[model samples]
Target: MATAGKDTTDASGGPGNTATPAIRHSKPPVNHHRAPRAATYSTSILPFERSPNGNILAAFCRAAYWTQGRAVWGALTASGDTKHCYKMDHARRGRAIIINNETFHHDLYLGQRTGTDRDAENMESLLSELGFDITARKNCTAAEMKSMLVEAARESQGDADCFVCVILSHGDDGAVYGTDESVKVEDLVAPIKACKSLAGKPKLFFIQACRGKFVDGGVEVVDSKGKHGQDDEEEMESDEVAVQTIPVEADFLMAYSVAQGYYSWRNREQGSWFVQAVVKVVRDNWRRMDLLTMMTRVSHKVAYDFESNVPSNRFLHMKKQIPCITSMLTKDLYFTPKV
Candidate 1:
């Protein structure tokens, strides 16, 4: 996130003007947490309840969606490779919210996620390497998630440059499993946006869950390293607002692992396709490529390189997935951690 990609105008890596990017689904309002919230890093355990619906492999690409913050958000870890990263203080990089829900009411849930913890572990390692102070938790209920987001935003000290949140759980389009129940993507955004402390700051949300129950049946094609759809330039839609006014919810970037209404893929032991692609791209091209470019590469990796090997015939068609990103950033973003 070295603010190097400010010039990006391509749909894949640019400041988009969509007033409110339309997502595949929406959730009911999350009643803002009224109680005094606990510090994000406290030793307190997450309160829990149980039962659910959502989907299979919805949490498959939670790590895959870890884009939307600084263009090279994780490049802080690659400081040995980038000279500019050493110019900024690494301690001020900011905070990240990592929610990995693996356990649920077995009788009521579809199935237990056997490999999600691996994704969470790998994610924490990558984020830490990149310089984020992480507030990680597991098996949280819907209410806790809402309260957590509000607190995360409110407690975000003004000195930090950005905020990040990653949710890895069972989900259905704009909704994710909260151990005992499901919550909407919009509900999560509303409270964080309501917090005045984080206004005007770049915030990113990376969601790894199923948007719907669909699969991509790929057609045979010769392999090539060519850019897939560079020529198609669609005009951006814009809406004017009052001058100098910052909407309560501006400067957010959302990176979803799989496209809406489709299944996400992950290995039982290695981790998710999206997460792996992101780590590889940012690690190898930290300075040469910006975060937006890395995210586009992530989509390409998931869409073309990986394929599912689930034994069931029902899962055969789930051989591919495409990552999605939506942004409302108004300025350039970078990850220039001080030496």
Candidate 2:
């Protein structure tokens, strides 16, 4: 039951050395079918900055919810009778929403890990550490991701302050590829907006899947001479607690590995770029920075550290992705112990 500073090798004959596969272009099977709408809104843009006080604990908890409990090689390996060991819930100040659909069909990719119990055990340990009540399942259909989204949102209302979802599997633009099915992105995101207690607070989604198959040719573009002053100012001025707006689109953030219609990278050995960056940043800076600032560093680290070494020794490139902020937060949040 080691909680702090422990290392245990995965039973897979030591740790998994195979890297999670990087996203590649593939056409989603055409069905000409659409999913039912729960609710929807346009993504908003906001400036990013560092928080004056560090609140790594809160940030870590949120990220934990989205990560489906898979983190650093063996950070939270626990054993024995532990009920509610695998559910996502809020910590000291906020609540969480978790969505995980690992099991898919007998596809060429995503089957082994998604269908195994190892993945669930890994996530259970991670969530337990953060005091989250986790809900996880294997081999869910595409319709399941959407249904779970609605249920998770409804469950978080009374106690939880924030909402978070972590999706693991194949995906396409504005949609997620479930086992033998595809669920629109709107199906997952819209339900939270429809919920009341979960509304207005931060709705965070961490998607670890391919978005599209089309790789873009290298192109040169002009770098804008825009000053980064405004971001800094906003960073410093945030001291009030933020909430949602009338349209229920005030406070939210979506962290995607690749842009729309692109692929996200992963290794059979190292998980995925977005997941690694998230754990690395939290492990390194959670005690010193706010969530937004910490994620910015993660965005930079993932975009740079991950390199595609397959497909003829050519490095697959990902565009510069910023940790998008759709802030309705009025006050500053710090996970650091207050002095």
Best by TM-score: 1
TM-score of each: 0.65, 0.55
Model 2 segments more than 4 A misplaced: 1-103, 106-130, 216-248, 311-333, 336-339
Candidate 1 clash figure, as a count: 15
Q: Can you write out model 2's per-residue Cα lDDT over 64-102, one digit (the tens) per residue?
A: 543433431122335331221221233432434344444
**Reference-based lDDT, residue 6, model 1:** 11
> What does candidate 1's lDDT look like per residue over 1-339, in tens digits?
100111111122222121321212112223332333433663423221110222212222222333433335455455543433222333476778888765554433334444567777777766665667788877777777787788776784566667788888767777786666677788888867775656766787888776776676666678733222222111111111112212325678788888767766555455566677776776655444555667778778767766544333444422556788776766545554333
Q: What lDDT would candidate 1 get against the real structure?
A: 0.57
- Which residues of candidate 1, in runs, are more than 4 Å off? 1-91, 224-249, 311-318
Instruction: Tell me the lDDT of candidate 2.
Output: 0.45
